[model samples]
Target chain A: MNSVIFKKELKRNRKNTAIWTAIVVVFTALILSIFPSFSEMGEEMAKLMSSLPEEYAKALGMDEETWSSIIGYYGTYYGIYIILLIGIFTASTGATIIGKEERDGTAEFLLTRPISRGSIVWTKLMALGTLFIIIYGIQTLSAVIGLLIFGEDVNWPVFTTMHVHGFFLVGFFTASGVLMSSFLSSKLNYMGPVVGLIFGGYFLNAISMAVEKVSWLGYFSPYHYLNLTAKNGVLELNLITCLGASVVVAVFLWISNKRYLSRDIVG
Target chain B: MNAIELSSLSKFYGNQCGIESVSFAVKKGEIFGFIGPNGAGKSTTIRTLLGLLTATSGKAEILGMDTSNEGARIRERIGYLPSEVDYYSEMSSKELLLYHAAIYKVADAEKKIQELATYFQLELDRPIDDLSYGNKKKCAIIQSVLHDPEVLILDEPTGGLDPLMQNRFFELLERQNKKGVTIFFSSHVLSEIQRMCDRAAIIRDGKITAVEDISTLLSKQMKMVRLVTTSVNNIVLPVGALNHHQSGQKHTFDYVGPTQDLVIWLSSQSIIDVTLSEPDLERIFMNYYQS
Candidate 1:
C-alpha cells in the first residue's frame, strides 16, 4: 500500500477521531468517577447473581464471586458497556471508510488516479486500524487515570489482557463491517447487515444466558472471546478458529476489491 | 506514436446498451473531441479507458499498452477529469492535487501544483467544499493536469464554467497541446469542440456513426447556400438537394454537389445577394441522428 494515500486518509479521518475521542474520554471519566461505589453495589449484585441460574453466571463470567471482587467497583458497572462501546465505534468507522468515497462521489476521482484498487482498500483498512489504535489508546489512558485516582492497585497484566481482547473484537467486527460495506452500495444498506449481525449475535448470546440447555450458543457470538475471566484472567481464544474466520474476511475483502474494480460507478 | 486507440470497442450493462463497436485513434499532440448526447456512453468509454470499468468486448490501448492489463501503468501517463468534479470535501485544493500528484509519481509535484493553481486562477488554500461549481471544476482540471501526463482525458471539462473561464480553459488546453500533450475530451457543447479539437467523433445511441477531421466533416456535411432574388421563380433543383423557403423572395438550398454549378444557376436569375455558409457541426449531428 502507498503511504501517501494512507496518510491522506488518516488526515481525512482526523476530525472524526478527535470528536469520538472527546466523547469517549468524557464518558470514561464520568463512569470512573462513580465506579468507587461499586463495592457496596457488588453485595446486591452478588445476591442477584446467586438467584440466577448456572447458565447466566457462565455467560456473564460470574462463575466465582472473587472474579468480581478483584476488579472492585468500576469494573463491575462499566466493563461490558466499554466493550460494546468500542465494538460499535470501530465497526461504524470501518463501515464509513469504504462507503464515504461513494457517498461523496469521490470514488471515481480516486479510481482515476494511478493507484490500484487493492492499494486503495489496503490504505483504507490501515487508516482505520490507526484510528482504532488511537481511540483505544485514549480510552486506556483514561482508565489508568481513573485507577490512579480511585486508589486501586490493579493487576497490570490482567487489565492489559482484557483491553487487548477488546481490541481483537473491534478488529473482527471492523473486518465484518468492511466486507459488508464493499458489497452494499449505499450507507443505509451497509448499516443494515452489520447492525443486524451485531444485535442478532448479542440477542442470541443473551438468550443462551437465560437458558442452560443452549449455553453453547454463546460460542457463536464474538462476545465470547471478550470474556476475559477464564483460568488466569488471560484472554483465551481458539487461535485456529479465529484464523479461519479472519481468512474468510480477507477473502471477502479481496472479492470486494475485484468487484469494485470492475463495477460501474453508479450515481 | 498514437496516444490512444480503440478498435470495435463496445461496453454494455447487462441488457442495457452502452457504447458499441466504436473505433477511433488519437495521435500524439492532437486534441480529439468526443461529441455525444447525455447517456451516449462517452463517459462509459472514458471510464473503460481509465480502467474504472471493464469493457464488455473489443480492444483498447493507451500508449500501445492494453488498457485492461496495464491500467495502473497507463494511468501513470494519463490524467482524467470526470464530468462531476467530486473530491474530498475536507481537503484544500492544494492538498488534493498534491495527493494525486504523489499517486501519479509526478516529479517536482509541489512546483507543478503551484504553477497549475496560478494558471487556473484558483485559490490553493480553499477547501473544495467551499468552492463554487466552476471553481471546483477548475480544481479538478488542475489536479488532472498537475502531473503533466502525456494524454489528458477530460469529460465535460468546461461544463459549469463561465464564458471567460471556458476561454481560459481552452487556452490552457491549447498550451498543453503545444507542449506535445495529446487530449481526448468529451463534451455536448459543439462550439467548444469546433474551437478546440482537430478531429471529432459523433456518438449516437451507443454507436459512433461518424469519425472524421472536424473541419472536413463540417465542410462535407454542412453545404447550405442562401439566395435572395427579385422574384419567386420556380427553380428546378437536382435530386438529393434540400430546398427550403427562407422568405417570400428568398430561398435556401443544402446540397453535397459542386457549389460552382449552383452559383452559376443562381446567377441566371435577378439575384440580389448570395451567401454560402460553412457547414455547422450541430446540423451534421442532427442529420446523423435523424438518419
Candidate 2:
C-alpha cells in the first residue's frame, strides 16, 4: 500500500470527483426541493402515473404508490439519475486509473520503481475505492440535508438503503472499468467500451423489466436490484444481485492484478 | 560479483520472436554496451533483464537476484532510463521528481532532484506536457540517476538531447561509474559506444555476434579494398579477404587483417589502381561473424 501513489491518484482525479459529486448531490437536492408540490398534488400525480402504460412505467422503473412518500419519491426519480451518474463516475475512474500510466508512457518509470506489481495495483484500487466512499458520503449528506429543509416527513431507513444499494450497482461498472483498463494500451480508448457496457446494461434492465419472458436481462444490470419500488423498505444487507456484483468486482480486481503483473507492457 | 548476468535469455510474443538466446554479463564497476539496430531485440533484452518482460527459456540475475521472481527487490538499487519518456501531463517536473523519489524512499529527494535539474538546466516547475521533447529527455535523465542506484540501465538514453547535453549526460554517467555504479547501455550509436563504453556486444537479427573490449574491437575496424588488376585470376588474394566481387578487370572485397601485411601484398600485385575505405557496422559484424 503506497500512500504516495494513493494520494497522487486522489489528487490527480480530484477535479473529476468534485464534478461528479456536485452533479449527484445537486440533482438530489433539486428533486427533494419539489417534495412540497409532489405531496400537495399526490392523488393527481398518482392518476397520471397509473394511467400511463405499464410497460412505459416499468421501463422507467417508476412506482406511483411511492410518489407521495419522501424516501420513495427520492428513490424513484433521483435514484435513477444517481445510479446513472455514479455509473459514469466509477467506470471512467476505474478504466483510467492504472491505464493512464501506460497511455501516457509512464509505466516504464512506475513499474521500474522499487514497488511490486501487486502493491501498485492495490494502491491505485484503494484510491479508487476511497473516491467512491467520498462521493457517496457527499451524496448521502446532501440528501439528508435536503430532506430536512423541504420535506414534511422523511423515511431515514429507506433513504439509507437506497444509497447503500446504489453503491453496489455503481461498483459493478467500476470493476468492469478496472478490468478494461488493464487491457488498454492507449489513453481513453477503453472509455467507449466501458460507457457502452453501462448503457447496455441499463437498456437490458429496462427491456427485461418491461417484458415478461426475458426477466434474466434484469440480472445483467445491477441497477435493477435497487429498492426504489419498496416504500419504507427494510434495509437488507444481503441481496442476490449484491452478492453477484461483489463477486464480479472481486473477479475483475483479481484479473486486473494478474494481467497487469504479467503483462508484456509494450510501448 | 557480476552486476548483471543473463544466460540464454529468450522472449517470444506468441509466435513472434522478441529476443533469442541473448547471453551476456557485466562485471561490477563496468560500463557495458548492448549494440544493435532497431528491432534487433535490444529493447527486448533490456526489458527482460528489468523483469518488464518474462523470458520464455532462460534466466537473468541482477545483483545476484533472479529477475523474474525478485524484480522489486532487485529494482531497489537499479535506475532505468527508457528511450522515450512521458510523465503525468498535469504534474510539474518538481512534483513528478518528488513522487519518484518518494517511491525510492530517498531521504533527501528534493536536494538530489534540484541538483540534477540544475545540471540539466531544466525548468522544474513546468508541466511535463508543456516541455519540449529534449527538455523531457533531460528530466528523464535526472529521474533515472537521482537516487544514485548501484546499477543503471539506460536504453537509448540520448535520443532527444543535443550534442552538448549528451556530453554532460555522459560525464554524469562517468562520474557515477567512478562511484562504482554498473552501467548497462543499450544503443545503436557506434560513436557513442566508442566514446564511453569499455566493452560492447553487437546484436543483429536477435542474436549476439560479438562481445569484446571496445578499444580492441574498434582498433580492428574492417577496411574495404578495390583493385584494378591486369590479371585478376593470376593474383593471389590475401587471407581475411571476404565477400569477393569481380567485374571485368576490377576485383573488390573487404579485408580484416593486419594493415601492414595487406599493404605488402598489394605492392606485389600488378594493380592499375587501388582504393581502400573503412567499412560500416554490417560489414564489421560480418567480418567478426565469419571469423
Candidate 3:
C-alpha cells in the first residue's frame, strides 16, 4: 500500500469519521444511561413486556431480560440503531473513498502520479479500514464505560459476543458498500444507496423475525446470520458465520480492487 | 532509443474510436507537438500513453519502458499537465504540491514548491477551491514541474493563463527542454505549436494524417495569391493554383508551386495590382483538416 495515498485518505475522511463517532458515542451513552430507569421498575417493565405481542417482542429480540439486564437492553437497540448508525458511516465512507476521486475528476491527476492503480486501491482500502476501526473501537469503548457507570450484574460475555457480531456485521456492510460502488457510476450519490443497503439488510432480518410465514427470508440477510440480539440474556459467538462473513468481505474487497484497476478513468 | 514511441497504438470505446492506429516518436530532448482540434483524439492518445485509459491494442513506450506494465516507472520520470485543471479542492496549492512532491519522493520539495509558486505568481496559502481557473492552471503548472521530471506531457497548457503567464510558461518549457527533458506538447492552437515545437503530428478523426517538421510545414511553398487585373474575359491559370475565384477580374487563388513560376504567370497577366502573402499556421491547419 502507498503510504502517501493512505495518509491522505485518512486525513480526508477524518472530519466525517469524528462526526459519526460522536453520534455513535452519544447514542451509546444515552441508551445505556436510560437502562437503569427501566430496571428500577422491573415489576412494571415485566407487565409492559407481556402486553406486547409475542411475535412483535420476538421480532425486536426483546424479552423480560431486555429490561432486567443492561446487556439485553443495549443488544436490542444495538441491532436496530447502533450497528446501523456505525454501519451507515463506515459503509458510506467505503462507498465514496475511492469513488469520490473519480466523481470530482481528480482521478486524472492522482492516476498520473508514479503509483500503480493496484497500490492506490489498496492504500485507500487500508485507510477505510483504519476509519472503520476508529469509529467501531470508540463506540465499543463508550459502551463499556456506559455499562460500567449505569448497570448492575452486567453480562460481559454477552456484551463481548454482541460486539464481535457487530464487528463482522459492520465489516460486511462496509465491504458491500465498496463492492456496490465499483458497480455503480462514479457520479452517483452513494449515500442514498449505502443507507438503503445497510438499513435494508437490518429490516429484512427484522421483518423475517416478525412474521413466521416469511422466516426463510432471514437466510438472505447478513444480519440474520450474524445475530446482534441476545437470547434469554445470553449471546453466543457464531464462529462459522463470522468466518464465512470474513471470507465474503475479503472477496468483496478483492473484487473492488480488481474493478478499480481495470476501469477507465474518464475526465 | 526514442524518448517516447507508440507502435500503432489505438484506443476504442467498444465500437466508437477514441484514437485509431495512432503512432509517432519523440526523440530525447526534443519538443514534439501533437496538434489536433478538440475531440480529435489528442487527449485520448495522451491518456492511453499515460495508462489512464487501457489501450485496446498496440503498444506504447516511454524512455525504453513499455507503458502497459511500466507506467508507474515511466510516470516517475515524466510530468503531465492536463487540459483541464482538476485538483483536490480542499487543499491549498502548497499542500497539494507538497503532496505531489511526497509521492515522487522529491528531496527539498518545500524549497522547490516555494520557488515554483513564486515564479508562477501564485498565492500558495489560499485553498484551491477558492482559486479561479487561471490560478488553478498556475497551480497545475507548478505541480507538473516541481519534481524536475525527465519528460513533460502537456495538453493545452495555456488554456486559462493570460498572455504574460503563457509566455512565462513557454519560457519555462524552453528551459526544461534545454536540460535534456523531452516534451510531448498537445494543443489545438496552431500558433502555440508553431512557436514551440520542432516537429508535429496532425491528428484528425482519430488518426494521424501527417507528421512533419515545423519548419517544413511553414516552408511548404503554399501562398495565398490575390490579383486585381484589368478586364480579361479569359485567363489560363497556373497548374498548382487551386480554389480559383474571379469577381470582376479581382482574382484570388491559393498557389502551391515555385515562386518563379507564379511570378512568370503573373507577369503575363493584364494586371492592375497583385499581392502574395504567406498563410499563417491556422490556414495551413485548415488545409490539412479539410484534406
Leading candidate by TM-score: 3
Instruction: Give the per-residue Cα lDDT of candidate 1 at B167.
Output: 84
List of clashing residue pairs for candidate 2 = none
Local distance difference test, candidate 3: 0.90
**Best candidate according to lDDT:** 3
Evaluate every candidate with DockQ and list the scores.
0.68, 0.78, 0.86
Candidate 3 on A83-131: residue-level lDDT in tens?
9999999999999998999999999999999999999998999999999
Report the number of the highest-DockQ candidate: 3
lDDT value, residue B9 of candidate 2: 90
List runs of model 2 lying over 4 Å from the truth.
A183-188, A231-244, B223-280
Note the Cα lDDT for every prediction shown: 0.75, 0.84, 0.90
Lowest lDDT 10-mer window, candidate 1 chain A?
A65-74
Off by over 4 Å in 3: B221-241, B245-286, B289-291
Rank by lDDT (best first)? 3, 2, 1
TM-score of each: 0.86, 0.90, 0.93
> What tens-digit string does per-residue lDDT give for candidate 3 at B103-141?
999999999888888888999999999999999999999
